[model samples]
Target: MSTKQKRFIPADGLAGLKQNFTKDALSGFLVFLLAMPLSLGIAKASGFPMIFGLVTAIVGGVVVSFIMGSRLSIKGPAAGLIVIASGSVIAMGDGEIGWHLALGVVVVASLLQILFGVFKLGKLADFFPSAAIHGMLAAIGIIIMTKQLHLVLGINPSELKGKEPLELLGMLPSSIMHENAHLAEIGLACLLIMILMSFVKHEKIKKIPAPLIVLAVAIPLGFALHIKTDGEIAGFALVKIGSISEAFKNGLINVDFSGITTHTGIFIQYVILYSLIGSLESLLTAKAVDGMDPFKRKTDYDKDLIGVGIGNTICGILGGLPMISEVARSSANIGYGARTRWANFFHGLFLLIAVLVGVQFIEMIPNVALAAMLIFVGFRLAHPKQILHTLYIGREQLIVFLVTILITISTDLLMGVGSGILLELIINLVNGASLKNTFKTNITLVEEGENYTLNVKDDLVFSNLLGFKKKFQAIPQGKYITINVSEANIVDHSSIVTMNGLVEEYKDGGGKVLVLGFENHRQLSKDPTSTRILKLS
Candidate 1:
């Protein structure tokens, strides 16, 4: 994008502000309305107090929106980052220090992200295959689905905290079987509202954020039905906002940083995981948002990375949750007819205004309503058919997808991604040398008394040296190996080093090895005085 195109703030101040104010304000308000329930839920999932989620949402809307270069992206505590933040909090304090240290960690992580952007490392996303990305996301959806089932039923699944996710999945039905009436009613209400909103077809209805509608209904129903009748429902009972003051008060949290270095490995682990996941999620959201731009604005990924990094750094410092480019809010902004980044700023202002104004009445909303919204989000993410469709693309791609999904769900994100990359490298290596244009490449397997020739034409470099090493290693227990690089244009130092290593390995294996090329080639060795073909007898 050119300078004029990338410019978000119009040169004309007052006039530009006026031209955008109303439309941006409406878009911002709509996004804020959509974000409220989600922000709170994801915060809770992240092991933070409900109020922390709101603070992050507010900061993301107000602070990050102002600085972010990407138009129409909504920033908040994403479900994706909950794993990192939760792990960070657990490792940092476990009730020892304040929340300040956690803030410091966020700042450090964000700085790393900003540096990644500065260095133009956004292209790293291309290294991972598309199938793996899909599989990773699919696994996340499954995790969310399993976790939220308890929320949907109005029971504290965390009560069974030590239980495995699969075990908890089996335990949900029995909990519902002996459920409290209030819990059952709230659960059913959330599910019903979610279903209706998700499946119902109407132009107007589709535009309205379903979660807001659920809240509007659930709050009034809670008051009318007095779901809290006869005191606590169980050993633990439902909590209603007693007053705006209390709701705000319960949200204040502390962070601790002293032990962070003591747990330096854990800290780095969280930072790396958060940076990787946050980048992928944000990039995907940015791409989708760009597709929706009416003026066809394309986002600069590097610029977005820096913007989000700044947002997250500030969020960590201020006790707000880590922020990312959220698709939920981004799509909502687009659907609401937002034209520019101003829409994001206005949305933040709307959230601030809503909290200030709605405080007195905000306590009336029910948890089940928010749970319903999450259930909806989870369903949208867990597209089971996607797996089958991906499989149709290729058998190898299917294996990659399945392996990634299973590993991610069973182990962790990093392991799954690493496994996928390793699998891809192995597959590519097995396919043998394929050359295009004037380049000629050949690999021949030899056994018994047969002779094998590995040929190459055109530029030969360090990477291709690995192939040579593999071919040399394949020499039979009592067979000779020959490498023909006579037609090569060039060989890097690394390639020569590799050949020397191979020659030693081959001789140690009691196999004969020969290299036929370097005798007449210039720049073939580190020392100009040597011109003999590197050979092992």
Candidate 2:
């Protein structure tokens, strides 16, 4: 393909398919191994049958891959969905009625996502501030870590399947105070896995996926020979998966449209919540995957949303769990050298094969091993270094991240996300630029012999960056402009990157530009100093 054509063309879809066949197959097997335990764990967390997660992973990977625009994303039951799904399932009974009804609600909700994508609403992701997104995700990481810790150590609270963090937290003190031996041993095992993961920092070792190694060791150890505790009870006794027939007896299910005929308002509310969370998660994940693409390729976000909507609808119809573009699985696929969507297909194929043919053998796998894997995953999410970095970036951002984490752990995802967004908006408004200066501070034009000095005052954050650039951009073609930032307190990384690009573009266009008064700017440190650049930092 010509360069122009190549830019627009999708990756060698057919060629990537043929070339990555083996790689995709291998990736599929690996993902299957990782996903199977997760599927059951997430489903159990959501207060649903363990089999539901397997169904979601299998169908989501196979069915969603084709419709998705993102080459690297893997769709499956998301941890983010557990809170909502669990609630919906409970609000709706036992047997097919409650679960199927929730599935019905999901189908209706997914239609909204389709509508969002059709209208190019994925761009709404841009409206969210980067600080807030980070805060939100960081909060989610914290919540997941705290709640899953109990599971990592084999402590099953007699409460509901998926209780919020606050409720769980309230119970945690007692759980720890009374000291459940199973919980203690499991917790210790999880800690060990996390330590092992941290020790693996080499490039080659890092590529091995730490969670996989933890599971490889933990499962065999747990299953082949059970470990005894001080109480003489085996640690593996608390680990549970029940049976495969639990999933197959009711292989597929559908919601009762008839119930919605009576309580449409509540149904509509739940439906909207489902679609909103699914869309936001998918949008964020797509952007994340794009960042990881070696070629800097961008996925069409709207198209991917549509694909997710379609995928969810099918998953609902087939008694599958709600699906989203899971970052963990997607990153794993990329790490495994997957080059095409065929990798996703193969992943799904493997999931199905495992459940169908290997179910008997798979059942023998101990939950402690899976729990060990998740404990490592949780550690990565709630890394203390990342939290420290957030604090260093901005106290407001740190607060937002902390609040999100607390609320997520203490309450639920919706409340946590809502709290983060609210905090983010407050931070933005408080730090927002002065409207008067933002609007009126523009250079009319460069006059003859004018040594155009653009004096930037105070902090030059992104909110006022466009105005800063506009003044320079409007300089007369034949005149000179010296951009001064000596008085400036700070410069955002985005603005700095923009400044670098502008400098090159303006110079190439035969315009003389001078950047002065910036010596030790942290933003500048990330970029190289070009020959034409005079200012440093």
Candidate 3:
């Protein structure tokens, strides 16, 4: 290990815990505050019993915490999986039993994810087009926002299952006439709070959890209006969490395979959806978390995948949502100064404490508040700014992005993604990418005494980045490098973004790296990172 690497960790594994415990514990508490509300919101958005999200968080923070290869990543139910989980429930016919059966599919998927990691297939994420994935996620965000917009406005769209996102969006004006004014006011208040919190200037004020702040006001006001006279809230939906003991007693560890046999086709579909999306999202999030780390430690991607898979399997059997290395919480963990896995474990501990000691308080939080938070998150995902950003990239990229979003909104997740991939291939072929060269890259590396020049040509997109990065990494350490992409006809968002990171690493390691030949190639956007280049014929 380098001296810099050693400086981050102590003598060995557990020994580092003592040095990191205090800061990690403090960070864990803050993350717990953020994760608790998000876990609830994500689960509600996913069409599962909201408690399942907390259960997933507990297992992720505790089990995966001990085993995860990444130091700062905190595992939990991610917003990206809301579509997969909600779609699975709807596919299985949408009921309590349907959700439990979905958990069965999660178990199967988790097992496959473990196998994928064992086979070192984490790089499979690289095969998907970057724009397409972003488009898919943006569609999911639109779906989430459309669904939750009703709750925020206090109008439940008559029947939510199997509705087109456009149809859901059309229901927005209906809420204006029929919405419960009181609840809508609260929801609007929470939404504004979330938006305003982002712009807060003071660091200390910024540290206050936005969701917690919303809940603080919403929960107290719920009683002020006598919303809950008995066990149930009169007009509004309450956050329902059955007893902790009941969670374990739900025949935990017994995964019903009846669905796999009876709905073999649907079961297989869910398995693929859960495993592929979960693994891809987890691997990507872990990589992003590594990039965000102040210590500059790269995570073992395969190892992290295997750990999350194992943890997810346990959560599956326990009737919990599938867990991933949740990106938002992981970023928060790093921001708050977590040094070891104990921070994650402590987060789970705090969540457990919340469940045990503060169940009533959690229940006191209004559903609209949670809905408002999710709606804000959904808007963030599918914001108009993102669409404009995609359009700025290029005609081809914008085509892929819009196609993926429209298809995903019109059809299901699988078909939408499939269509996106197929369209990407057709676009490439139309742009003069030959069949053989499409699969094979044309990179030539030349070395002269004090420097090395890499000549790259043709498609340099996400699909070929694994090979490209491998060759890039093989270059000797501490050597000046020049990457000449002037000859390349196409280069994508993920490739350029990754190459920029590598260039930064090269510069940090006492070696200079230069990227040349982009005077004519148009930059996609004004953003410095939107450097995706393409040759216009």
Candidate 4:
């Protein structure tokens, strides 16, 4: 999308809405069905009562829909937030009181997210190397798998507690070998159904989200087998989903106002954790969803963050999980013809309706099915293809990726990512990129009647070139774009790659690009346009 047209696409007027409501409502219902199992699964995986996840979706859709800057992006509990939310509870004693304490952390973290938006710091996440981000997330995926795999086998490995994910994973063989055969049958069946359904390439069949199908199969199968809802079979059972009647029994808005004072230490820890991770994830997801919007709209990432902060604050008070712009749901929204934020609102409305009317039926669902769904989610996050994709970028990048993953699994999230950043900086320095070049970007843009020119005076590198992308993306389509790099004495691989990718994209859109200064540079690997132009040469 052209930078000139990046503003939020507002909802259609009444007449326009009348024309599109059917498409929007159908899209919303589909997403609603898809979100139900996910919400329950993510919340269960995140160590919160299942109801909290439902609350997050309700607030995410109803509150964030009105305020978010993206037209079709959905907001709700996500797999990404599982570690932080669960860890927050665990750090505070892992009980009813701990859950209440975590609410305070959400509020503070949300305040910080708003601050980030206000400061227009949405691009800060771009500084992290793509390798590092992927590695850290993959580690998170593995962590999720380890925790949820137990539930999938219908076993509670809670008895074999360990600090690190690997340590806990060590007990997996035992957990599986002696696993509850019956519930494991259900979980494995659900898992296989999900895996196999992905190959059903027909558009209509693909439209049916896999998680819903898991329940369709598992629910009836459970009833048919007369599976006991509560019992320990090899330390596992067809687990109950807890008391649906007790949902919101405490209150619709269950903020523990005194938690800020009572759990100040853990509260502060989570504030930092949630704000950094939540804002990063939300901004990144919004950026991705923007590219997915069939209408070719560009979402305002800063505004979306602000809206998420506001929604998360409300969810915090209401005993809900922290919310973000979820990529999966948002992609489904666009694919299903969501016309506006009304689709998001309707998705939440449907969730509320389902919970209100079908709480009993939903409760009847065995926990193993939800566990299987999360196991699938975990695999997607750390899929082998994704890991290979990173490796294909560069072996150096692979090193960074693996290091980040290893550190994250061994240490904590913050430390793991921090180590990756530091390592990448060291690698850059070793490659002879100057510190000044890494931090400074001096760009000048000139326009001449449907033709535009962007000039760079300093070395262009990842640390500073994000601004360059913002400027470059603003040029209208079908205009001549001359990225006059002639004056820039030095440019790194990242900058060159960015320039090359944009050039190709612009040309594909019937625009023109003239990259002026890279003719003499040394090529980096197989990508001809990716070269290093350093003054030392």
Candidate 5:
């Protein structure tokens, strides 16, 4: 008889700390190096005092780590939320009062996130089509790039203020022409470092985070060029992190809620954006990190939502920007061999200590360096491969993706996503999906001894995925199972991906599974996960 080796799961809480303290602490320190500059950049781009970004990171790391369900994700301010945060700040008023009013919106949105978790609505993230989500992210990337490019070229902030994304993009040529030579030199150098580091295939060198390298080069260059005391370089060129301890002294009382009454419409708009988008991004990041975990551990997403909500609530009260399970830092944490949530805690603790004692060093970081880093981030999000991959999936998917990006760039995030969903629905119906069953699942389960079968009879699409997943997961583990989708009018990319995941889950639990019914269907593209529709023959 052959014996199967069991997988080792890491301990949790204090025991986990005792077991993996050295490894976790090292990962935390590395993540801290990466997070510090990115957090400052995200905060600056979001129109809040840069120091508040660290505040959000501290709360996310120190407090949320203990409560969050994911073991390895690093929570902090993310580039993804910059658009909504900046918009809220601008819509509320514009300056000190604007930030205060925006804090009120963050509080309400975070409360709603808590409600979402309490009600077990994290599954709602599954309802969004994969293409639409990618489109939304790509749109965000484009927006980030457009707004930050001028900064990278050393254009004056006063000239770029109040300009829309398209307008900013249009001004790029002019900005480049009139760019400050010395500041641009630092920015371009930092951007070059980011680009080069990304292609580093050597494992040890790759482990050194790119942001740290950017800082290493930019800080010295800033001093050599005399950015702080120079007459030519603008005062805003260097980052002003300010005093974190002093900020917190009055931060607790800084939140203003009068915007709820004064700008009622905008208040509601931002609340929806902050809660819905933030929750979606966090859940998605946690899921991605789960896939990357060495032990194949799954996150309790509802619990994670609650934890992140608590973090956001605290950050709001302290006048900080919204936070999420930031993908880059979290990935870096895993890469550095983080063993438990303690890695997140240590990262936050280190940030707290640095701000308390190392404020001067942080303040030396130039704004253009941070902008260069963000521009690199934006490039990754909007990379051409994303578009090519979507096209490789299916022309319909490409259309939906492009539509979402165009509408988002021309209008706003909510409208762009809404339009993408609507267009996807129309495409499904035209492909023979029944409108009545669009959000309803029709899978009949049959059990015989230890053998089980699922007969899918309706369109299997993203809108109805949650119900299908619930039904699929209800089956007893370690049994022989078969799924027949022959009768489904259409099987979308989202449904195909979910079914693949469920099959893996079943197999991992020592169950034998078979999937049938694709024989008479026509795949929309060469991709294995592309949508399928019944052949008309």
Candidate 6:
């Protein structure tokens, strides 16, 4: 008789470290190379001293890794949080004072994040529609690109300061015309390298991180172009990493809490943004990394939120940018064969070492090179494919996505996301979803031995998804479960996607799940996860 082969699962905690030390260390080193430049870029973009970025990353990896719920995710400062971080700094003040004030905001927000996990509200991330989240990210991407493009073209920071994203975009042509020749040459060269690296398919070559290659090429080019000389470029052109040792010697308690009293309204606003958005992004990244794990491990979202919150609190106290379970670095860690959380620890250890001992080498890096890297990152976030994919899902989804992006760019992230959610509700009503069931669960469960049947009689939409999930969770595992959405007035894209995930989870736990009632419904689009509404007789 043939038998199914068993899959090996790695041990957790100390055994995991001992068993997978070599693989984890190697992957951690590779991810360190990727994180170094990106951390600096994200920090500078957020209006903080670049060295603080490394500080945040170091804490994310070395500290959060142990406490985090996900085994494979690499925690660190991320490009996704740049917009909010920068906004906090700008809103609080502008320069050194602004940075310290923003740190205060981060501290309060991180405490709230801890409370969120304590309350087990990590699933609240699911409350945001998928299209809206994508749109929010795309909007942040555009903002990043617009702000960094001027730097990439070697425009003086003084001239670019205080200009809005759209206004800066309008000044791009003029900025290019007045660009510093030597700085622009290096920046453009690095930008070209970043763009070309994406098209490289050679297996061995691809294994080398792109950021390392950018640094290799840009450093020499900087020297050759005399970028450091007063004749060729301004003093601000080169990165000012400063002395990590000196900063540590001064003290870690650098945050300014006075902003809470002086800028009460703005302080509360930023606190909400930092905690809400940071938790959402970290949870989503953890979920994505879980899907990518070869061992099929799952993350405890609440624990992960607590870990991230702790890390952010530390970063804020030390005057560093808030951190998250960064998606790109986490994905790269998986690709590099990281088997445990130690990979994250090693990455942070390496960054700590670099800042402490390699300050001179880091100072040689050009600000424009970092700007080039960020611009490329921004381009990926707002890429055309995101729009195309959303449209392929459904026209209504496209509307929500576009509206989210537009509002995010025109106003702020909070308002933009709120608008998207509101618009989706309106669309749901237009499509015949009943108002009475919009925010409440209307499900009944029947038990028959090992078999359970769930009858959903209300609209299955994002607004009521949390309640629906709660009811689903009450069902015992390792049983046959049937979900009858046939009576549901409308089953949205979000609910459908969530249901699909629940089915997979149940099956993984030795239970069988069968979904019924979609046969009489009309799909909003050809995509399998698209929303469905009952067809007219």
Better of 1 and 4 by TM-score: 4
Q: Which lDDT value does model 6 have at 340? A: 92
Scanning candidate 2 in windows of ten residues, the lowest lDDT window is 524-533
Clashing residue pairs, backbone N/CA/C < 3 A, model 6: none
lDDT for every model?
Answer: 0.65, 0.65, 0.81, 0.78, 0.92, 0.90
Candidate 2 per-residue lDDT, tens place, 330-368, comes to 888888777677777787888877777776655555555
Q: How would you order the candidates by TM-score, starting with the best?
A: 5, 6, 3, 4, 2, 1
lDDT of 1: 0.65
lDDT of 1 by residue, 1-537 (tens): 796775554322346458777777788888888887788777665656566577677777777665665777887878766656765666666322424556667777789889878997664554455567777777677666676677666665446554444676788787777665675576578678878877878877888887777777777777666764536443223423233355445354343455456778867777777788788788778867876776555577788888889878766755667888888789889889777777777777776666667655565666666666666676666677776666555455567778987897777778887787666445433432223411222445444465666665544433344445556656665457677777655543334544665565556556777877776465422343222232332
lDDT assessment of candidate 4: 0.78
lDDT of 5 by residue, 1-537 (tens): 223334677889899999999999999999999999999999999999999999999999999999998999999999999989999999998888899999999999999999999999988989889889999999999999998899998887878888899999899999989999889999999999999999999999999999999999999999998888877665788988778667866636678899999999999999999999999999999989988888788899999999999999989988989888989999999999998999999999999888899999998999999999999999998899999999999999999999999999998899999999999999999988999999999989999999999899878999998888998889999999999998988999988987898898689778999999998799999999999999887
TM-score of model 3 vs. true structure: 0.91
What TM-score number comes out for model 6?
0.98
Candidate 4 residues lying further than 4 Å off, grouped into runs, are 1-16, 160-163, 233-245, 257-265, 444-452, 470-479, 486-512, 527-537
Model 5: clashing residue pairs? none
Cα lDDT of candidate 6 equals 0.90
Q: Which parts of model 5 have CA positions greater than 4 angstroms off?
A: 1-6, 249-251
The TM-scores of all predictions, comma-separated, are: 0.74, 0.74, 0.91, 0.90, 0.98, 0.98
Quote the RMSD, in angstroms, for model 5: 1.5
Write down the RMSD of all candidates, one decimal each. Answer: 14.3, 7.3, 3.1, 3.8, 1.5, 1.6
Model 3 Cα lDDT, one tens digit per residue, 1-537: 888764655322577677777888999999999999889988887878788899899999878877777888999998888888988877776767788788889999999999998998886887888778888888888888888888887665344556767888786787677777667777888898999997898988877888889988887766666656633335345677777777667466645667888779999999998998899889888878878877667777888889999998998888789999888789878878888788898999999999888888788787889988888888877888877777766567788889998999888788888888888777766654556666667788888976988888876766667767777777887898999888777666667777887888777667889999776466656555554445675
